[model samples]
Target chain A: MLLEVSAEKRFGNFLLDAEFALDCKRCGIFGPSGSGKSTLVHMLAGLLKPDRGKISIAGTPVFDAARGINIPPEKRRVGLVFQHSHLFPNMSVQANLYYGWRRTRKSDRKIGPGALTTALNLDHLLKRDVNSLSGGERRRVAVGRTLLACPRLILLDEPLTGLDAELKSQIMPYLKKVFTEFDVPMLFISHSLQEMRLMTDEVLIPENGCCRKRMSTEELARSSMTSVPRSYVNLLTLRRPQAHNDIWIYSWGDEKLRLIEPGEPGDNLFELGASDITLFKRHPEATSARNILPCKVVEIFGSGGRVGVELEGGGGRLVSQIVHESVRELDIQNGSELFAVIKASAFRKIC
Target chain B: MLLSPQDMQAVWLSIKVATTATLVTAPFGFGIAYFFSFARMPGKYLLECLVNLPLVLPPVVVGYLLLLFFGQSGFAGPLLKFFDLRIIFTLTGAVIASAVVGFPLLVRAIRIGMDNIDIHYIQAARTLGAGRLDTLLTIILPLSGRAILAGMTLMFARSLGEFGATIILAGNIPGVTQTIPLAIYDYANTPDGDRMAMSLCLVSIALSFAVLLASEALARSFRKGSADAP
Candidate 1:
């Protein structure tokens, strides 16, 4: 395994106990706020010592509480891109990126600055002071700096939390490129399912303070509703439109779906949260919903008093959750034909 | 040409003593300040109080304490004799007395600078495989330049005017240990020495103004450098 951790820590009322082992080149830890996601990453990076248990990276035991072996953070060879992009205020962009480059051994250097600068589109930014860069620019530099360190593994903490839509779109492509080009394992932490899908194939979902499950992105898309809010349901593939600048148009069978924003690279799936969608027994006129797809009910699943009606329409599939009373009133059943009503803003694009 | 050869020697001695004291106190001050800023240990408050004792104590008492430690019959007598180094009533003693009096000011400035540094920078440095020393030399030291410079200047200024401590430990020696302040006191006590004292006073004012101006310029440049960073 490239990374192995079974650690427990307690902070007042909150307890963090996470255990996972992964050899995948790209893996993600997905959870909501206060899920102990950051705490888990910190432990793996050796910033915080686990009260008990062991953590190993690339076959080297970096921390073994029982054996009294704990390696310091500097020697752990795990790089982290902080949420705030903590670039050194005193150095230029070139200096900040090279700060780690100069420290790594020549034999360990898998990539050089010249190529990285070109790939990250950082040629014009190297000589500028870190303070002058925009939010998106700073994030790019932070990633470059961490990657140049020649670490065996990398950890990125919520890299897209605060960026505007424009900045997020600008930086996401570069980040995806880095994820694929780097030959080391990476542990990405995020609350956004779209970001997780874009970056990793496998994911560990943390709830409360423990990693409750580990699964692939495909499984997560198909069965993500267990831990997520009721609004989010199945993930469906969407074909990119030929030439749409602001809105992405995906045509299913004969139904056309229009999304507000562009999707990340390799993004073929769109999340239709059940709450954002409604079902109609007959085609209604004068509705604000931009997407009205004719679908056939394929399956019916229920939880509590809510009913999840899976529909296959326009060469795509999705689920719509409605109250049991509505299902009874509308007589929703398997093989029943219905129209799935989706707001243009409700479609969340994911890779 | 308003000053005599003896007056010139006094001015020169003051500069030498202040410069030496500032240089000597800098490394110790930085280390102590860095420790106080970052390290967590038992009785840290007590250690901080001990380091800052010179700031609140009387200068004469500080000199007396130095004398007791470095005197011929004091606790450090053996060590001093082993090195064949004389500190009591010598130029070196004056330098020591000035450094002792100015130590706290230096540390306070440095500690404030160190305190303002974000822990994230240090964490980032470590994750990038930069060790403690490496981070200190590259990140902390460069970023804390203004504070270090301010501390050194404050120490130098304090050392220039150190009088009570110098009188007790180094004594009033004309061409050796007598700095500007000690020389001024001597001239004030002697008859027909008012003119020389006035000239020295003007010279002292001019020197202090130059130091302050230089410090201001340095601080401004640091600000500009950060503002223009790209």
Candidate 2:
């Protein structure tokens, strides 16, 4: 894991109790205002100490209350990009960029100034006074400064909050480009679902101050979080563009993906929640449907006409829903190829 | 009339004393002001009251208090003397008295400035990987520049017109510790030379007004820039 944190802190009347782990990958902090999101990020970066609990980055203990280890911010190889930009007005943009870069110990340094400045398009901005830079430009500079610090993980606290919507879009692409080009893990903090959806795949959802649950970006997008578990799906999960990050990764209603070399097959890369599919008995053959996994009505569950059916598609079992009336009328018992009809469009690529 | 050598010396000495006092005490005053406005330290209220004591106390009382601690046999008497420092009956002592009297106003201005500053800015700095000191130097201080400038100007104006403390500590030595306020007092004390005193009074008002205007203008411009900055 790139970062692991469990902390509880109090400021004024607000209480911050947050805990989560990110496996050396980009993750996001999503919560509403006063949800202790900023406080969580601050604690991760060693900017604020927790009254209880512990935090570590790559197994390096940052703050451990019982062990009595509190690493200072400068010593923690965690970079933070504040929502407010925090540029040094007295210095030029170049000076602000170099501020943290200069503090990095020689042996541990990774990304250098020239490379980061070029990547972030900071060469032209170096001459401008930090106070003179616009919000977007200041944010870019702030991100670059942190990157140049050669940190193990980056912490961004609602980096887009102060900017206008258009300017936020302008800076969003740069952040994506940076994330793609560089290997550094980042913990993006934002209450806006739209912003979180656009930037990160791994989401840590907060209940009060603590992370109550975790969901992939695709799950978060599809579920918009409703109480009911969508509906019992009765078709094969399709492989398509709507299931992944932006374009979508084809996911199955039954969980079988029709694709080639999915790379490092982790169980979490795909999930066919028994709720998103519709099943049909008559096998309509000529549709542009790329996947036609065969399933039998093993059992039926749910009430008032709607029923969930269990299916065995390619060793991995899945459940689908068929109406109670259809279940009784078709006499679709243990072994019948109830044609699972899933549109390739319905499959969202979430990985 | 072209200014005489003694008049020119008084002007030079006044400038030097005011500048030295303003620069020397500025950072300490900012620290005190920030502590008073933001920190949760114990005895904060008492500390604030002590800092503002100079504003209500007579300038000579301030000077005598400085003498009680900084004089030949005062609290800091031996400590200062250990460094071959003698504040009694010197221009340095005059600067000390003026700084003490001016400190309350300086801190008051800075404290208000610190209060007016948005705490969000500081929190934002912390999220930017800036440690406490870096945030202070880079974020807090620059943002607080207008306040610092205002405090310095206020202190200078008070020091230029300061008389009671200067006379007691520095013994009113002409062309040395005799600032504009001391010089004005001396000229007015003479039987028939009110012109010099009136002229000095006019200059003091002009100087004070100029500093006040400049600081306000700078502060307004700074706030405007922050607002317009994207």
Candidate 3:
């Protein structure tokens, strides 16, 4: 879906002036609190009217101030999953899931209840009241309810922010599966960089009530290394896990990685901080870290006292952050060969 | 068995008038409550004050206003004449008086219920492709069902005990517009009629108690229905 929005709004003292045109299946509206990310979502979904602007989805104008055309939310065919599940307390899970589908035009309904219920794993809880479901279960049901509406563009307004670390991991896969299976375009909004990387390929950064930049998701993550307190986070998606006695071995591209955590048989995502990887000029004769890989430097970039070294090894690319003095001592440069040592505990399973 | 034929008529007439008044006022009350709870419009405070005027004013004062509005050579004189409907000193007049006196209580209960409903539910329904009317009927109505029942019960009880307004407008006729309170008024005024008046008072207490119990039971069922899905 292509979303085009150029709108301005003023709320008492804060002013929001955002203009952007994005065409991507998975887009992220990345911003801190009070940065107008939600305001943009609301305007696009037709819940909040823009003062003077035109917003179009897939080449059709949903809101045009010059033409006096402001489509109501129900007619916009843009679904939204709120931060809280906001499931109708009076409805059963089945009824809540089908509420949107029943209201949609017959011809416009592309997703069936049978497929959605199975995809969301809601068959067992269909007869249960919405209030009785757990937090993660409620979120899954909320996603199902929005997807069943067959919206052209789905806006997720920090859907996972309310969940804990464990529940966030549990619900991320379900969200990924539904979006990919249904092929619906989505704009994920959140303040979490990890969530942005997991859910979107491209991102729009808004700051202080203004849109600052638009770039690839990876680029945004890389550029944020210098500013974010956590530094750079290396996201790894490994597959085909095998139990190795006390530890688990997962295949990473052409190499295998040993970790203390066990992963599912199919695929699992893990996060390794750049600062966790120590680069050595020669192969380490002995070390307490579990995994050590021979890699060649692909790129070196960053500023200040810290620098990021992009390595092409261990079956894929990994970025390691080190001080400027270390870069000089190791003589790190493009095409430089080195061995990267990482502890097994450094790899945190995200999902 | 404890009363004459006239007393029995008064008992039945009280129930009829109260029931009719409650049933007639309920829909309008819900509509007005919904407006006050949700709708954004100009001059809303004025309308709110007008709707609540009967609550603070004496019931007799309300009856006098209604009498003037529906009386011959009054504001609605020509309209009533064209319809050829006589409201003065009739059963309908008694019902109108009861309804006017009880409307504020009904609206107040329902409005409080509506105010307590989270706005997100309405937004969720709207984004889910339900239109305005659909959201109101399917979501708002069912969610506020208990409150609506509570409001109806309060109005019914108030109507049963309405004395000042009915006597002023319906004139306490025998076997016609005289409800329980009007009949009690008659018995209390007559010499040596204290026992009959006391009996009617006991019956009033019993009726009010039954209304309260039935409403409580209905509210409990509503709660159970929401808690346990079908």
lDDT scores in order: 0.86, 0.72, 0.90
Candidates' TM-scores?
0.87, 0.73, 0.97
| Model 1 lDDT tens row, B1-230 | 99889889999999999999999889999999999998999999999999889889999999999999998889998899999989999999999999988999999999998898888888999999889999898878877788888999999999999999999999999999989999999999999999989999999999999999999999887773333222
Clashing pairs in 1: A127-B230, A128-B230, A129-B229, A129-B230, A252-A314, A253-A314
Residue ranges of candidate 3 with Cα displaced over 4 Å: B224-230
Quick one: ranking by lDDT, best first?
Answer: 3, 1, 2
**Error of model 1, residue A86, in angstroms:** 0.3
lDDT of 2 by residue, A1-351 (tens): 777778789777677777778783778888787677777777887767899988989988989999999988767878888777766555678877887777677886777788778888889988888777777888999899888777888888888896776687567767877777877888888977667766788888877776657888646644552324455322222443233432234444445554432322322233344544556677767876545666766655555545666766653566665567777787767776776655444443233
Order of models, best DockQ first: 1, 3, 2
Reference-based lDDT, residue A275, model 2:
48
Model 1, C-alpha of A76: deviation from truth (Å) = 1.3
Candidate 2 residue lDDT tens string, B156-176: 888887877778878788876
Could you tell me the interface RMSD of model 3? 4.0
Alpha-carbon error at B99 in model 1, in Å?
A: 1.1
Better of 1 and 3 by TM-score: 3
User: Which model scores highest in TM-score?
Assistant: 3
Error of 3 at B130 (Å): 1.0
